[model samples]
Target chain A: MIQLIAYLIIIVLTIIFLIKMIPRKLKKSPPYTCGEPMKFEKPETVFYRTLSNILGLKKLQKLSTGNLNDYLLMIFICFMLLLIVLVMV
Target chain B: MLAPYAVPLLICTAFALPVFKNEKLIKAIAILAIFLSLSFVLSSSIEVFNSGTKVFAVSGFKAPFGIVMVLDKFSSTVASLILFLSLMIAAFSSKLVKERVKEFYTLLLLGIVGSLGIVITGDIFNMFVFTEIMNIATYALIGFTAKKEGLEASFKYLIIGSVSAVLMLLAISLLYSHVGTLNMADIISRIDTNDIYLKTIFIMLILSFCVKIAVFPFYVWKPDVISGSLEPVAAFFIGVMTTTTVYVIIRIFYTILGIYYSTWFSIIAIVTMIVGSFLALLQKDIKRILAYGSISQLGYIFLAFSTGLAFQGMYHLVNNAIIEVLLFLSIGTMLMHKKMMEKISMYAFLLGALSLIGIPPLSAFFSKFFIITGLLEKNLFIYAIISGLISIVTLLYYMKIYFMLKQGEKKIYWPIIILIIAVLLLSFVPVWLQIFKGVEVDLLARNEYVSEVLRP
Candidate 1:
């Protein structure tokens, strides 16, 4: 019963997130792969940087925090995943 | 004994790789090892065709307990294809790529071994082991360039692949608790199909395979990874990795999962096809375009296999791999020039592009024809219509690529000519044969496969 409630809460939050992330104006070009290199900032969390180094992913973790479109797309993808989990769970 | 040597020899050579510092000698050794393994696979596959399924239990342990390798029509067909393609890639790499050659070949060989293991293993745990091997090799190889792009792509792929692997391992562990075995055939024979947990496990496994094969939703990493890798690496990933993953999906489809959930599979394929086409249409980079094309092609394989036309699916799988490898190699040669493709390279690219577009007399067209026929036979009119529309979409993008090219003269033509003739001959042969032999001798021959492994 606890697990069921937890799953429901996760689903509701995910749906809310997806709905918020969807842009009103659909852009003709995606913000990703604009042939420019991404510059990521230092991680605010110690845990994230530590984990990153351990996994040899410190290099990739430097995604540009400034790209609005990538942010939305990433969140949008997260929502889709959460929706899938809703079905699976 | 001979058929199973490919995987072990590859693994051993990979371990021995770091010891060598002379890059040229390392490359020569890599080529020689790949050639010898290819020869072994060829001989074993021929033997299997002439007689029956062959099994090699690792370290002499019996089935339901030991790691087992299978050499039958299904595995040999895909394995030999993987090897032959790898050999081509070895030759291609030896000529072009020079820096970090040692580490690159090691990863390449490891990736090949992992792919071979997927098709040849009889144990589920062994499959998981090989999956890790493949994923790690791929992660390292993609980032091999150490440029920000390559590192970024490899990192994304690593995160996604690791999550999927964890999910798969969890499902497998749960399954072992229920069934007390990890051998695929052993588990299949003992599976409680109606069990709720079993169904969940099945879904988890499918999800994992989805990530590997770059199906919709989970395919986010494919474009970056493909676009950022070196030419030969891209060819191996696009050609061999996709084929092996689809082969495993087909194997799992037959041996474990029943047809009760096929609708979901078809729906996934349809969405994948539509999404792949739209995104592929949008891509500007050559490698990313080819990557999206691979994703779209995988949908056709799934659609045909979903409709129970396994033979047609296998036909497309093999055909697509060969076509894509030749295309990449030809394009690699062209890209070696600063601004324009030479005449010979242009024609070679045109052959692959025309084949990809399903132009008549090309191999891709016949496979697509058989798939459409299968869908129509099932009265899936909507699906058939959508498929026809997608074929036009495919042609549109390929034509876009052709229009984008500017020509200059270059010197690589013979390898592509050999590949083209092979594709043409394969496409042209056996049009009148009524019954398709299918990939059953290795894939569907579960009883023979199981018994052979279980035998002393």
Candidate 2:
């Protein structure tokens, strides 16, 4: 039981560290498009606009995702959970 | 007495890197180190074959308290293959790796040492440490090019590999907690007494090994990383790395856990075989296709072992390693041609593809036949049919690659002819099965592995 708690704490701390390391200024960038700039966009609404653009919910949006480390991490977490269940069973 | 040769040779080669001013001297050192290691492997294999088993207690400490190196038929055979393939890859690396030549050889030798340690050591903690060393060296080797794709692939591998390592460590901890001994033989002696905790630890260990073997769902990183690395490095990684891991898995399952619970294992093996083959048939990139083919082949080996066919599994492992090395060597040679990308050599590709698909008279066919026979002996008729169907799918995928390559018109190189002959000679050699026959032939009834290891 104590070991399980320790594992949970480590996981939480790692996730917190990842989130805190994100750059605030970079997160506030204007909405990005593939070829053209937005002319009738509200500057105050840039965060949502950029989020939509990155998620491909906006016109001419190019979702340029970089590495796949995050996805691998998620799959690894899933496997670990599966292992824990298999052991506990 | 000669057991320390592996570490010292690696250290000497690493230290003498700066003194060698000429490229020829560096190449000579690389070849010398590998040749000496190969000789050690050969001598040790012969000793094991004659005397049955030889154990080296490091610094003269007793079992369960100190590190032990056991040279049995199983370890010696796998070790010999590792050394021989490393020699061939080192020769190939001389021409292949121009950038960071010294560092390449250093890491390559270190990786070889780690793998050898994993094969020979009887202590579980030492196995974990050796596995880490091997993983770190291989991760660096994969990212040696430092290109964007290489870095990305390495990062992906690093993340997945770390999780696997953690799982393995956790499994070790569980075992230690239960058995109170890290020695494999000691653990085996105590395994039958424990009930619930033993099953928990067993499941954990199997899960960790599944990650290492990349069975079915745990295999996503292999294709990406293998395709992204350089040709010779890719060849070495496939030829040696995966085989050693699978060998260790076999050791753990058969020698440590015993085969009383083989029914559970058989189910897992069948799933991995079917799924891996289906995925292999859908791949497009040549290297990715080969990577998937290797996973499927490993599945067949697992199936053979789960049905209490240790000799057949070992034979399949040896044959698969030889075929993969020859195939990758041919691919590496073809990749060196100036116009290779413009018009890929059809003959070279066809030979590689045919060898992978278990074509008649090839090394793969013999191993595949052994596995099918084992399955039939166990009365696994449905699995036998599934295995046959997947074998056809494997042939179809490989034939597609061959036909696509053969569609182009280009003069075949001399190296391709050499590779063809090497593959043919390997297929003709009955050395592995002969060794199996010489030893206790019926591995199904009672495994001779532990007895062989403790013989001396």
Candidate 3:
């Protein structure tokens, strides 16, 4: 019983701590890499500029696609989870 | 009983560690504690090997009425690996960990103890408890540096890990509902009798374990978290913790679930191999690249194990553990030099990279060869070919790192040389083969292990 209460307290504290730490607003400006200053008008523009700086967007035009990699990874994980559930059911 | 001593000893030593304010004294105590644990692990492992299997019923209760610790070949192997890697990391961290030495060692020891419990425990509920202990220690250790990246990585790992834990707990509850017992062997014996819920529980348990082992699609957090943490801790996890998880999964699959219902295992192994290698090729960061490489390597180990050749798979496990330790130690050595380890040092890193990539005459090549052979023996020809091809892709990424390190300015260091020699010796001498042979054939086969655990 005591162990259960301690676990609950820890869980509540951790959740509160995480909620407090989440950033309130997304910064809209040029993407920062290693604290190097850059100029960009919009967040979307910053994405392209950052990509060009990191992986050379001009050279990557042939391989670039509208689909985001992070989205694809998320989709993959979701599919796996779904498969696991289906198998269990 | 000796079974429970492992956890209390580790916890007591961890608590005592912070009392020593002096760095030197703390290091001495940490080393002493770790060495003592290692000796205990060795003796216990030998006992298990000699005795076929031994079970320790906790608190004077019998079988399903109490928690039990089971020491068999699988658990003993994992325990030995954990202790061996802990010893190596402690030696490496003696010089590496600068600030909060006591806290670091405490967390490290705690992590080891938790993982050891996970490996040995026969009770499913105890497994969950041990998993939580291991997870908390890991989260704290990852944030030990207190840097922005470290904190961010730890938070990410913690969130994902918690979700995984919940999934596991739900599965365990479902199993308990069906079986009315938490003891693994007891549960296994009764599992086949339940026709309606058997498949559901099996799938849930397997998925939960896959998440823990970082197989295929569930492996996303591993690279970021491992790469962002302290090098010694990262190395220890890669060398020991992940492998132990894999061992537990294998134990559950074969000993608990029985290998007759293992059709999904082969499919998962193949997918993990292909996807892991593909992603590894795209990574640029040195540590992240190694992390992905480990994922790919583990996929091969899984493939080997699922092919019904347990001993051969066990061989790969030992080999992989040795190689990972050598590679990570070398990388850590490089990072400790004059310049902070960054995007540079690509040239000197080639040896370790090439070996990992399975270039001939290195340790990885032989292990990969045996895995393929095991697959072929099982008539898994397509998988054997796929495994071979993925290994080729692994070589390409390894070369990518090699070329990058090559382009960096060359600087000779004594630690790098010593690390290189160590890697070479491990790969060339084949010390593990002799050690395992001696243990399994001469000592363990005699059933001394069971007697030790069953002894009054």
Q: What is the C-alpha lDDT of each candidate?
A: 0.74, 0.68, 0.68
- Ranked by lDDT, top first: 1, 2, 3
Better of 2 and 3 by TM-score: 2
Worst 10 residues of 2 chain B by lDDT: B438-447
Q: What's the lDDT for candidate 3?
A: 0.68
**Taking the candidates in order, what DockQ does each have?**
0.02, 0.08, 0.04
* Winner by DockQ between candidate 3 and candidate 2: 2
True contacts kept of each: 0.00, 0.19, 0.06
Question: After TM-score superposition, what is the CA distance of residue B45 in candidate 3 from its true location, in Å?
Answer: 1.8
Task: Please give the lDDT score for candidate 2.
Answer: 0.68
Q: What is the lDDT of residue B178 in candidate 2?
A: 77
Best by DockQ: 2
Q: What is candidate 2's lDDT per residue for B152-173, written digit by digit as tens?
A: 7777778778878888899899
Residue-level lDDT tens digits of model 3 in B120-193? 78788998898899889989999888998788778877877787788789888988887788877676556666
After superposition on all C-alphas, the RMSD of every candidate to the true structure, in Å, is 12.7, 13.9, 13.5
**Candidates 1 and 3: which is better by TM-score?**
1
CAPRI band of model 3?
incorrect
- Where is model 3 more than 4 Å wrong at Cα? A1-89, B1-4, B338-352, B406-456
In the range A1-89, model 3's lDDT, one tens digit per residue, is 43235334433543453344333455566577789856544443343355346744343232213223542355347546755655664
